[model samples]
Target chain A: MTATRRTTDTLVIVIVMLLVWQALHQVAGSTALPAPLPTMIYLMHAVASPRFAENTTTTALELAYALVLAYAIGLAIGVWMGAHRLSGVVGEPILVALYSLPKITLYPVVLLIFGLGISGKVAFGALHGILPVALLTMGAIRAIPPVYLRSARSLRLSPWQTIATVLLPATLPEIFTGLRIGFTVTLLGVLLGEMFASKSGLGFLIINDMSLAQSEDMVTVAIILFAFAAIANALLLWIEHKLHRRV
Target chain B: MTRVGAIRFAVIVGMIGALELACRLGLINHQTIIPPSEMASTLVTLLASGSLNADIARTLGEVMLVIGLSVVLGFAFGLVIHALPRVREALDPFFATYYAVPIFIFYPVLIAIFGLSAIPIVLIGVATAIVAMIIATLNGLDRVPPVLAKVARVHRLSPVTTALTLQLPAAAPYLFTGVKLSVSYGFIAVIAAEFILSPTGLGRDIADAYADFNNRRMYALILFLLIVATVVNGVLHALDMRWAERRSGGRS
Candidate 1:
């Protein structure tokens, strides 16, 4: 299909969906099921409110800091493991176990150690983010063509030169994949922490509104968050597409 | 034992021993980090007490229900979406971006609509899990080779027969992959729901333990959860491998 046709199709579908939702709201006539128009209005107001700005910044900042820490440590460890045979073998099982293990189960442990604040949330998010990056980085390095390494060695290139010219470039794609997955889980981890225990942030806003029985406000917060997440994911996917094309 | 096995065993033992030593030497606070021995004893005590059994059963039942529901609904959704090219194209972007949105965010809305009960919790799990199955199922069906369709037509098979005999078998692997992903995703979603919303279940108990600062119980519950997750994943992986082997053998 043409790009314009696809865009038109999507818009039509979205409109139909919204109409159906609005119809349901009208039929239900429940406070919980606010019509989309009203919900959108509430969302607009919420967006403009200082409170939303503060919470948005708080959540974004938390995610940013956690992701940065996770990226640095996870990249270093993953690269180290990828470079070393024995260390990778020793760590592989533990990494796999931790990967499958719902890291949310460790939220309580984090809370205990870091106390109830952004520190705990950041720690939890970083923990969630690290594993995927580490695993992917290890796989990427391991999968690098042995011929390239052999050739590099034959050239008598220094270790730094070898990594710069070969390993780093070769592993960039997989590293991007890891970053994408890590960003997602880190976002979830932080949100989960905030929901479980927090004084502020989007999660807290949702929980707080729910308790207060403010359905409109709650939906508004959810909408804002949903938009933020959807946009972030789309951006990452676009970057990946561009990078893949270049490669 | 394999070299890797020996190394893993050493790592675990070394970490636990280090923690135990730290506790004994008063270098680590018991309030923050419970010794491995104490955690083991607590696990034993909790098992003997039988209090954990009901919680485990409840969580398992909820997760099983969610996975079952997700499989059925997701398959249907996939079939519909796949059958309609325009619909699929229209929603493709949303579906692609959907996974990153923490479906947990919908819990409050669900609770508001359904009230504080198992209904909302189960709904949350199903909602979170169904998307993966849908994507997988669509991909599975899309992968059905055109040659197989031609073969079915040559045999004068009805569309229904063709789907049952050809398309399904061809798509079985992808469907199984969908189901496997659904099971694990459902497990995670259900546990998370229990933590935030449910009044009872293993997650609630863990939350309660955390609140009370019962480090031993908290660690013990987490350990049990880890075991369950690992065993389930291991079983699914084995099943996947066996299925692959059988398929390859049949092809050979």
Candidate 2:
């Protein structure tokens, strides 16, 4: 397809989707559903609100805490486990069990344990985020090139030295993959915590808006969250790509 | 079993037994974290009474619906992207953008529009699966060996047969990998959806239990959900391994 036709097709999809949304809004004719334009207006209004910065900052802080903790812990355990096959297998089953457990169900346990505080949210976020990182890092460590081990040994490197120089470098790509997965899942977890377990996060804002029947305000917040996610993911991807190239 | 397997098994059993013993001996709090005996008894009771049994059925019903829909819709769109280069190129960026834009962001809107039903959950699951499927199919196409393409040409195979038999089979492993990943993620997405907005199902049950600070109830619900998720995927993994073994033997 030519660029023009491709662009047109894209526009068609976007415009058509919006038009349908707008048409439905018109038919509803209630505050329950705002027209596309009205929603956009509300979105702009949300952006202007000082509360936008506060909510966004709250989510960002919680997410950073969760992501960092998950990565640090997952990497340490995953590297150790992945270094040995037997350990990997035994540990993997337990990890998989924990990982697959509908973490949402644990939120109650989390809330109970941590008592509706940031501690609870961060703990929940780290739990959601940690498993994939560990698994992915394990996968990465397993992929370490054998020739590097041979070379390191030939150079008379100690076990620690070999691991630091050869294994760590080789695992960087996979480690990044784990971190990316951790970020995505952690964001989800953090958002859920904020929504269900908090009084002030963006999630709280959303639930509050919904309860108040502030439909447009809710959508605005939702849109901003989506935008933030997109930007965060894009930034991570760029950094990962740069790291891969540099390494 | 091999000695190593037995040792591994022993280690795991010992760990669990130790934990149970700790709780029993008052080294751990059974109320805060139930002893294994208590947890097992709870499971047994719930299963016998059929309340938990029915709850599993309820949650599993919705999960199955989502998975069923994802398989159909994911493959349909995936095939379109695979076969049609024009369509694939045009939609690629949109898919990439969508991936970055957290689907959870849509939950509030979905609940508003659909009102906390299974439909919204399924939609989220299916949507999560779609891009993964398309990427898998596309990547699989690119993975077809050049030698295989030449062999297909030499055999004078029709284009359709080449796609179905050669390309699809070549892509089979990756396709399976994609589906597996998608299903795992799709399940997570659906559960999270329920946890976020639903009025019923496992997610809602957990939230309710949390609100009451009933650790036993909360832990029991989580364990139950874990078993369901693990059993479903474990079964799928077994099927996949069996299929691979048969195929490898045939090739040999």
Candidate 3:
């Protein structure tokens, strides 16, 4: 559990992964599955290219838009349902059902409604994100100790002041967990949308490379995405741990 | 049904009716979304005709295969890793970050390696689902009371017997949770892989229907998938809740 041991373990895992990659490349051939070293080199080149920058920016913009929509709508619904007991009773199961359902099945419907554009991708990504954010946020609010609200009332705080001082701080940690999960799923949703139908973005590039038999480029892009996701999750988890400790 | 259950049912029916009415009134475009009734009727006809029997069987079979493989293999891995404290500690971060990655992006690469067959689909599904089971197994094993081990020692039970007779039943609830998760994840991953790119399956059928602009067929297929997913998940969730309640009741 020590930092040094953890670091060493991580290094070992990385080496093991590289070995597996190399073994697969050997078995599958370089044309099908490029070696890790070559893929890393290709990744460096790909990252520097104009095409990479453009596609990354497009994906980033779509992700940003989707996150904004997800957070706004999710928080609104969560707060409402969490505060209103009747609505929560009526709506919670429905939301849970929708959340469990394979939402990818509905992507075509999203495409039909939003059309084959950035809007469709953004909407699909937001759709994946909204459920988790809303569910967790609602749980967070409902979990707030009754004493907190009573204390706020005793202080004669206004509704706005009560929410700001008591409710917000009480719920922030759990709500942030929701946001972290939402961030992950939204990225997935956006990638899926692009993979299925899109002219640009990292997902499109991946599919494009596959069709063109650009094995190295494809592997590079996948690795880049893998690294990005892993690093972001680590950062978020660190913050989450800190938040939990604070509370 | 209870009052809340009745109200929930009514709310769902009301929403479906509203959609049907909107379609009937031309308020919503039929091209974008068919009426719920029409989707149901089409699905019934689709089923009666048996045109999609093969696709349904294939997809469901793959899903079953995925669930079975993931649960067994994941539990095995979990057992091995749990016994190895150092390895488990190392793997904690990987497990935490696993689901955060868009794993489906590698489907194409898998296709390239495996030559665009069911192998890739099954592999991806297992990759997506197995982690949940492993984590669940770890959690379940962790929660098995230390006293259970002491009792096993007192009884002079072998390690295998202890695992089978004591650990398994105690951990059944959490293991079931893992199964529930694995089922959902397996279902989603398989369908998504098929949808993205595959020779044949429900996902492929939907994709093809969309491409051919067969809105009726597409909507029916989509509806079928949603219904199946919802029902399966509902059943698992209900079972999970029942087990959870029993566990709590026993504790109290």
Candidate 4:
């Protein structure tokens, strides 16, 4: 499809979504769900508030910490397992099972260990992110063509050189995909941690508004999160596509 | 068992044994986490007591309902979309970014509209799961080879007959993938919804136990859920592998 057509289609979807929101608001009543226009207006003011800044900063910092830990640890595990065949064979299924399991059940244990603080949220977010990164990075390494490694060996390249030249570029696209997914899930994990227990952050703000019957504020936060996730994903996806094309 | 399987079992056992030793030796705090053995025993006792039967039943029933609704509705929507190229093109971006958006954030909005009831929980579950099914359905339909259509035309078969006999069988593997994803997503969403806020269910019971500092009960419930998720996933995975093998074997 042409770029213009795609843009128009996206615009149409946005309009349709707004229309649906309005119709649902009508049906559900203003108390339950404020109309889209007013919610958007509320969101603008809310974003300008100091409380929003504080909570958003808290969530962003947690996400950043979690992403760094997740990437570092996950890449280490992935490289070790991927390079060692036996470990990969034994560990892959275990990782897959962990990935599939609903990890929210373990949040209580996380809470107990880390306490009701930012560390707990960061740990939980990292827990959500680590598996996907490790799994994908492992797959990427395993997929490296044997001939490339053989050539690297034949050239007498040192271990560092082999990884820098042959290993990195070959796996960059897939690793980037892993990072993208890791970012998405880690954000979710942080938000969920906040919603369940934390005293601040967008998730907590949503819950607080819910309890206070502040429908517009709650909707506004959800919309902001939705928009943030959508835009971030689109940007990452575009970069991923470019990387794939280069490869 | 194969060598890898045996080694995998050993590794898992060793890890659990190490954790058990740590818990027993006070290297780990008992207040924070109970030993695995204690968790198992507590779970067995809890099951025998029948105290959690209602909650278990309620949670499982909601999951099943969510799965049924998502699969049926998602497949129907997928079929409609696949039949319309324009609509599919328009929806492509939405599908791509759907899971990234943390649909659970809307759970509160759902609760507000539907009230704090099963409706919101089920809706959230379906919302999380249905997209996977729809994407899988689209993939399955797209892979139905042109030769199948040609064969149907040559044989003068009805559209429904062609769909049932040729398209359905051809698309079965992809459809099964959809079911697998839907099941996992459904389980996660429903439990998470209940965990966040619900009147009653396994998730709620676990939350309540945590709030009351009932470590044993919380650990037992957690173990139960982990076991259930693993077993269900293992069975589905095995079936998927068998189907994959059969397909490759037949081709060879």
For model 4, the stretches where C-alpha displacement exceeds 4 angstroms are: B151-162, B250-252
> Model 3 residue A163 lDDT?
83
How large is the C-alpha RMSD of every model relative to the true structure? 2.4, 3.9, 1.4, 1.3
User: Where does model 3 sit among the CAPRI classes?
Assistant: high
Evaluate model 3: give its lDDT.
Answer: 0.93
Ranking by DockQ: 4, 3, 1, 2
- Winner on TM-score between 1 and 2 is 1
Residue B195 error for model 1, in Å? 0.7
- DockQ metric for all predictions: 0.65, 0.45, 0.84, 0.86
State the lDDT of candidate 4 residue by residue for B144-196, as single tens digits.
99898899999999866876798778888998899999999999999999999
The best-first sequence of candidates by lDDT reads 4, 3, 1, 2
Locate the minimum summed-lDDT window of 10 residues in model 3 chain A: A37-46
RMSD of 3: 1.4
lDDT (CA) per prediction: 0.86, 0.77, 0.93, 0.93
For model 3, how does the per-residue alpha-carbon lDDT over A185-214 read when each residue is reduced to its tens digit? 999999999999789999999989998889
**Alpha-carbon deviation at A101 in model 1, angstroms:** 1.9
Q: What stretches of model 2 exceed 4 Å from their correct place?
A: A1-33, A157-165, B97-100, B139-172, B250-252
lDDT of 3 by residue, B43-86 (tens): 99999999999999999999999999999999888878987998
The TM-scores of all predictions, comma-separated, are 0.93, 0.86, 0.98, 0.98
